[model samples]
Target: MVFSNLPQQQRELPEDGTTNLWGVSRLSEVHRVPVASLRPADSPRHQSEQAEHTHLLANSAQELPPIVVHRQSMQVVDGMHRVRAAELRGQSEIRARFFDGAPEDAFALAVRANTSHGLPLSLSERTAAAVRILTTHPHWSNRAIAAVAGLSAKTVAAQRRKLGPATQTTARIGRDGRVRPANSAEGRRLAGRLILESPGASLRAIAQKAGISPGTVRDVRARLLRGEDIVPLRHRLDENGRGGLNENRQSGERRPPVARLVAAPPPAPGRDEGGVSGIFPSLCRDPSLRLTENGRRLLRMLELHTLDGQGWQSVAQSVPAHRAQIVSELALECARQWQRFASQVRERAVAPVA
Candidate 1:
């Protein structure tokens, strides 16, 4: 299974103020779903790959992975070509995994899945997919969008530019699932003052207050202690993208790698309030959820994967290096499953229990 380009930490995001601990699966295990019952997926590829279909048709059914299906609409999310191949094989029932997510996200998932394995999406197809993502998620950083589209951040930036100023944003969500100001002189300045005001304050505390990373805060403190400028010498391009220093150097969008300096962090994507954990209690209390089997099932599903920040660290510490790869794969699979469930649930809000 493949996770989306966005970090799993922000799973089922841009809408649900929640990070997915886990999600309710419509079908807990792969089963034989009727071929006639499933719908054509909203694929990222321009068209079905005829060669891939032919290849799949030649393979034994046991050799192929189960096709992914949309629980609500019965649409395929990642395996339309497989579906075609199954149909050509004269199979009435095909093995399938269920994905419950919005139509748009389903498309993104399809792109990422296709990119991760199976036949490759052509360069043009990937470019088109990247453009669509930039349009829909204008606030997502180029790297985040590029991960899904399987393109370089540079290419993603170029596509964003072609989208014109209207689609350009002042802030963007980075690859690590952080929302940050495009330019960060203000944050650096603020960090410098915070360090001076409370010399004993922890780096995390200062970083949180200034909306910059702890790494950035540490650097700022180091500079202030030296009685030098808080801004890195390379970033002397300043707030206006020019002028304070280094006129001869490149000041364009792509700059040398340095600890990230963010302007100010924004609220979690599609949210103005608390993040996933913050909303967990309210969801637990909702009658529409607690009072019904469907809702309770979703809740229970979440409980199985519950791991807080410290819990994650403890688990990571305990895992043996020899088994780390298998653990990582399992962890990703869990995330992918929950992400699908969470997206679909959000798309429908609460399906009335009848």
Candidate 2:
């Protein structure tokens, strides 16, 4: 009945009655395995709760959920209470859903199942489970261990700290299932090489490839920029007795320039006291202030217009005071219009399909 509710892929029974156990697979049809072959895994449930559950199941005619078992070991990962209840009823066989993994993985599943169901694991029990998980899965992050053990990451971290320095030097397993180096030295060396090869690469990208923390990569980059030799001594030595210390200084070799944040240049002297020229002094000194190519062309045209004797004298006599203000406003409006048009075009180009 449970198998009927599952999707077509899961509902389909294996022809040989032996499903391939790998990764995570949806629960298929339950198999009636011999009760004598089903060994209980280390359970998080207290003995008192187990006895109470067994008594309840004996009086009721209800069919309990299938026990989760490891395919290779035939060890019960979850539903230990149901297994015990079946024994009390003198049942020769029990229904079971098989999972494919090692014993440590089965332990994680057992802990998760116990906390999620009836008579949840207590705080102390959860902490103890976290400690055990940390000991078994040293590569797992504190958050990952916490997730499996049903405890907070803070609690997991505290348990790890209690485990001492050896734990800190253990390999770290990331969510991607890749194992990182036990210590930061190898990571730093890799990061150093990457930085040397591609000085302009993003720090985050370099860190990811090296499997090192971004902060660590950043520190390595900073040291490189400071001309510090953070690379290991072994890498610094060549096949010959010569060292790579002076490699950059060798003939025809150019070292990568250090990247430094430069402050913006100070704004040029603003407008002159006389306001003789229509252009602001700052605009004349800074090319960036032109805002756009069209704006720069218009400014050049205005300068040529002022050079013409007839245009210059007529403008000076009529509205000399407002001439600069008018020109500046026109330039700003032109730049604003160009920016708005560019933005609209981009928005239309990237508009979502209905």
Candidate 3:
């Protein structure tokens, strides 16, 4: 699997700060470093004589992946077994790859590399490594911790619970290794602005431009269409910068009342005899089950036109497609509703009384 957020290009770092060099170009060169000069950062989690060692020994006649080393401390991060296997072949120096980072970061990389490849880490080793990671990267979420430590999120959560709460972190590392802030308020605001500017823009396009979820963008568009204020509420301030509820105290004027559409109470239980009830009887009986506000408004408009004596043929001919497409879509929707109602009825009929 590809590791996210790891630097793939070679770059220099300040003398005091750490630098990460990745890619096969950096790790491709197999430097022959003296075995005696190399030191293991931590004890081997798995026995070197396991199947991996045997396989390495069997392939000792050929080339193998270079061992990973820390350039700063000369500590071996991975491939202890390969180093030993090479030594058994009477080799003084072994091929190696180098990574330059803090010891802690190197250790974390080591744990991840070892667990993800070749021989797996033992349970105790994995637990210890997870604990160390939690202590070092306390802001990481349970899933993030688990991803790097080779454990389940539940296991990481349990470990965290045992250690109690830690400082909450708003930044999270994604699978691609990029760090992103969890907050999306700015994104939502941008989406709202875009929706207001381009009312006909597709939700997917708006979501992509705003870098927010499509669902959130859809909700913003719906609210805008409903005439709901998307702007957040702010405290009103006077000319002197004093905040108060009474705006008239400073401006000496009252703001006009904003017009809003409120749903007329679903006509009391049995009162819809002549209107919508004559049509969708089930929906009229159940106020909770009805079309969206826009749909209801359209339906009400049609009812008023019919009351004004406009025949169905006149209405159908007035539309561009001659109402064929509209009628087909409505019929399909009715069929789906009927199918669902039938299924529910059958289930209730067969259900045991309880």
Candidate 4:
């Protein structure tokens, strides 16, 4: 069976202030470089800044920021003004960091850095930068290029449409650094097929095979069992026949977005006192859960998550103010774990042997 990629642990952003947009790490630590050895310009701007601008920068009281230079070509990726100002001041050398990457990616990094700090690029200059980056990084999603070029994702998408076949691609690398399908409709069809043919397959196993999330895979199985479309109504292309990802969707997301919890069956129901509170007693009476070690382990795990309204309130109230953000994020992640757990339980209930 064919399967697509879903990493065990999604990549997280660094605290050191680096970003995924740069692609490759620096070739070496920051060090001084001879002013004469560097190329004059490879800036994101289309034209040189006015002489007064550089002259003013040369006279600034603050220290100048380091330049990012391509190690091989010895060309400046960013900081053309800084370099020129140094020369204006009669400084012999400048502090520099080296970039070891393809020339095209170096330009992408330059655009990103220029957008981040220093004098802002003009609207036209940023638009031009987006166009250039599209040619080089065609596989990057609209948001990724938008981030680098300081344009809105919509603006980048418009430019992408103008580029036509040059930028046409089925998969794109998002800002989080995970590559996913541009549209998910096709992946749902595949997930439906996988579920029908291999009813016993685990949700993660099928999710990887479908190029969709395990949550999505579980939805597909439930839809198949209930006689519904595997693809959601909103996901369908419109009358204009336009197809694209919904930026708000958690589909094709990661980087919990890719929960990998174990697949355990929801115990067969045998008794009930009623509502949500009755779920435990119902499962407790089932022989499948009562008889086996793994089944008993499943019961024990479920017991921990069976908190009532006040129980949850007490836990929420106990959180310290300083840890509010951290605890809230962790709570959301814990909820995702429960979601994956419930999804797998439903998929397993209808499994050939689950």
Q: Is candidate 1 or candidate 4 better by TM-score?
A: 4
Which tens-of-lDDT digit does each residue in 218-294 have in candidate 3? 87666555445332222233344323345454567554443333343343554544765345433322222222355
Cα lDDT for residue 203, model 2? 82
For all predicted structures, in order, the TM-scores are 0.55, 0.47, 0.49, 0.56
Query: 1-354, model 1: which lDDT tens digit per residue?
Result: 222233544222122211121122323478789999998877888876566555544464344667777788999887776777777778899888787766665666667767766667999999998888777778877877787777998899778767887567767777666787655667888887777578789999999898888999888877654435577664455444442333435544444544322212233444424654445555554434543457667666655444556666998999999999999999999889878977996878877766
lDDT of 2 by residue, 1-354 (tens): 222234554322222211122123444468998999987767765553457756776566556667788888888777766777788999999988887777777776677666555446888888888787777777777666676667888788778768965455346665445566645566887888787678778989998999887888888877655444454442343333223445535644544542222222342355233443434333433323232346556455444432434555676567657587887688689779868977996999999988
Clashing pairs in 1: 18-276
lDDT of 2 at 63: 64
Weakest ten-residue segment in model 4 by summed lDDT = 1-10
lDDT of each: 0.67, 0.63, 0.58, 0.71
Deviation in angstroms for 133 in model 4? 1.3
The lDDT, on a scale of 0 to 1, for candidate 4 is 0.71
Best by TM-score: 4
Model 4 pairs whose backbones collide: none
3 or 4, greater by TM-score: 4
Residue 180, candidate 3: alpha-carbon lDDT:
43
Candidate 2 Cα deviation (angstroms), residue 191: 6.6
TM-score of 1: 0.55
Considering lDDT, where higher is better, how would the candidates rank from best to worst? 4, 1, 2, 3
Instruction: Kindly report which residue pairs in candidate 3 clash with one another.
Output: 4-176, 4-177, 5-176, 5-177
Clashes of each: 1, 0, 4, 0
Q: What lDDT score goes with residue 146 in model 1?
A: 80
